[model samples]
Target: MTADLDQGSRTPLVSVLIPAFNHEGFVERCLDSVLEDPYPAKEIVIIDDGSTDHTAERIAQWVAAHGSEIPVEFVRRENRGIAATLNELAARSHGEFLRIGASDDYLLPGGLQAQVGYLLSHRNKGAVIGDSIVIDGEGNRLHDSGMCDLHGADKRLYDSSDGIRRAVIGHWAIGGPVTLLRKSVLETVARWTEGLRIDDWDMFLRLAARDAIGFIDVTVCAYRLHGANFSKTRHTATRIVNLTESREVAMSRVCLFDEPYRTLLRAQAQFIAAKIAFLQRRHTRVALHLATYASLLLLSKLRLHRTAHVHAEGA
Candidate 1:
């Protein structure tokens, strides 16, 4: 376990912070993946966030069997939302780097090493997001690169902080469970906001504003696709609440930008509101939001294109 694999230096310990929910059938696989990872310097922190099912029991069972493999800290508590649970997990961790794991997902071979390496070399980056191998609930290979299916994300956008900001504002996909964050950077961004069912997008927006996030194309985790996945919620009311929350998060970041980017963020929020309106069958409101959204979106795109063209010519 070297700091730089190429240099055979010290390996920085990674705190794997996993906040679990009702994932009884899958939590063991998640723990197994963390254990299977070859990176030697590690600290595992798993919290079963008030799961109604036997998720906490399953986690307990796994810990009892394998806790001695490394430094493991397990906690089972009343259900708080994901964001609060994540914050608590980070607080309990002591690693230089942190990998936020989902109890329903598992990591890939060499994934942690690659992510750590990237952050070490790019000190300006707060976190590095890697790709995920998409799989079904049964562990059947659904395909590869879950981000592609989930976000249709452009790999190149990850190359520049500006591009990532654009992608986030433009509602482009930035996918995965393989994001490894520097503990300091997390502190820089003030940690995750509590009470939000959706957290990653908000956190990434803040990180990108500080030019702290980057993307790696390597597959780092097995992202299980089950019906219960938050993004795939079947209930209408739950979906609306999530959408409303996400829209608020996007809107909250609009003040951090200028010109086209500010407009882009607003447009994205407006687009989300349009979807919410459609869901509520508010046809007139939906039509109005859609028209405004389309115009703002198109205007931002044209301005952004012009800016990029000038930059490319070194103007």
Candidate 2:
């Protein structure tokens, strides 16, 4: 009967932020999923990141056709990185919680509703993330789910009975669709690190450190794994460079000085980095990872510095 819901309401104002690049072929599917969401969203903000294709024009046509029935706002900007586009959208957002959806990805029906319910139940939890179904370029199911096992010295888990302090670091098994972050938590962290090649992991770690994360334990969205995707196009070296830089930045912001517990976290971070390095064929990083684990196992004081030595020698 009214536009604004009552206070203490379980219903949340969800702002779906879809940052589109040159995803003209797949952007429509993404928007359709959001618009068809069982739970009504307050707004759907799609930012065009300077696509050299017809993505913006198509989005414009959709906006004109749909109008206010589904609040779709389109903004055009010069080609900037995904991080910058997200930061800009974050600044312009007006929702209780924000869910970022890539133009290539789509939200499953009732996905947003389920997550909103969970976030309401767990008010203290600033985020709720779930697993996703992996799909191919032709919209064919590739995997039942995109969940990771994350086995290694750095393996991280979403739900741990051992408590947050005991959980492995840098190992939150979450995709962008799985996570719906409170605007407050995001505001505290400020905008994402613009121009950075990879900011999701860094941002997630920062948020997890400040507040405990809630896992939905369900596949709520479809994650598209395609050749034209960012990860596919970007060179392996670019990924390594960005990940290394972002990890350092995130660690600097985290407080790990008071406890031996930090040792576990450091070890986990090293393992995760090692996996990325392994993927990129950076054998030297893999060695540094093992050395870091060794230093931690020996309870050495110069754990990270010694690992740095390993990196230097390996290089």
Candidate 3:
């Protein structure tokens, strides 16, 4: 066990990584929340993902005005999307801990400080995620509380194969710019997947497989569920495509090869597919749930055969 140190000495150097797209309207509010964090050594890193609006201009102005008082760094990159932007920010950050915040989302007051305190107190943990308030586009709080995974609540730090298996099987370790992760764990795992839409889920499963994760019961962040959000604008099919692809990437690394694990994943994938189908109004496809589960059972019976066939077919 790692020895706990003094609060002054043990205050983990936290870098608040804010990846901004076309969030000109709410960027200031987001930054304000970060600035309000009571943590003394917090550093704010904002990466503008090629915003076509005045986002860059606004950040520049804020920097000029209060840059000296706050430890903030601003970078502008070509519109490479959120995954690439986050990876770039992680690459350049020097903090011992990283709390990724979306420009559309803001850390509730005391959010950063509280998370840092928890993570430092429990040294073996790799990440700490908490509930978040769901708000409308105008920052009006729609819901005071968020979701959690009852399965993961008992574990102080998640490691080992079984722990990872439970996490991957549709356990709701709610993520979306509402969690704090250790920079060292991220460095070891590398950056986010560039081609995936739900990169947070992928990253979480991978990290939890290797280390411990803590859950804070209180909501410490705000998740903006606006109409203009990426998930809302994109077609359901496109989102599902990304989700399916990302799930494959994660499963491949962890349990895609094992029989029981692969069955579990296929079942969960089918469940997600059904949910997306329902959301897309494809009622016919929603009935595919039973078929998907049946197919999984049949495939599991011939697991080795199917695995060989897939590999041989080069699919």
Best by lDDT: 1
TM-scores for all candidates: the values are 0.92, 0.80, 0.78
Give model 2's clash tally: 1
Better of 2 and 3 by lDDT: 3
Summarize candidate 3's per-residue lDDT along 1-315 as a digit string, tens digits: 222235556676888899988878888888888888677778889998999999888888877877887888999878988788888888878798899898888888777767777787877778877777778888787766645332233333233345444554546557456678888887566679887777777776666555556666657888887777646536866777765665566456546236645675676677666766777788889898758867875675577466668889996
Error of 3 at 139 (Å): 1.6
Instruction: Give the alpha carbon lDDT tens digit for every residue of 167-269 in model 1.
Output: 7777546554778999998767888998777788888888877778877788889888888874566678888998999899988988877767888888988
Clashes of 3: 2
Per-candidate count of clashing residue pairs (backbone under 3 Å): 3, 1, 2
TM-score of 3: 0.78
Q: Which structure is stronger by lDDT: 1 or 3?
A: 1
Q: On a 0 to 100 scale, what is the lDDT of residue 206 in model 2?
A: 61
Off by over 4 Å in 1: 1-4, 230-232, 305-315
Give residue 179's lDDT in candidate 3 (0 to 100). Answer: 78
For model 1, state the Cα shift of residue 220 in Å. Answer: 0.4
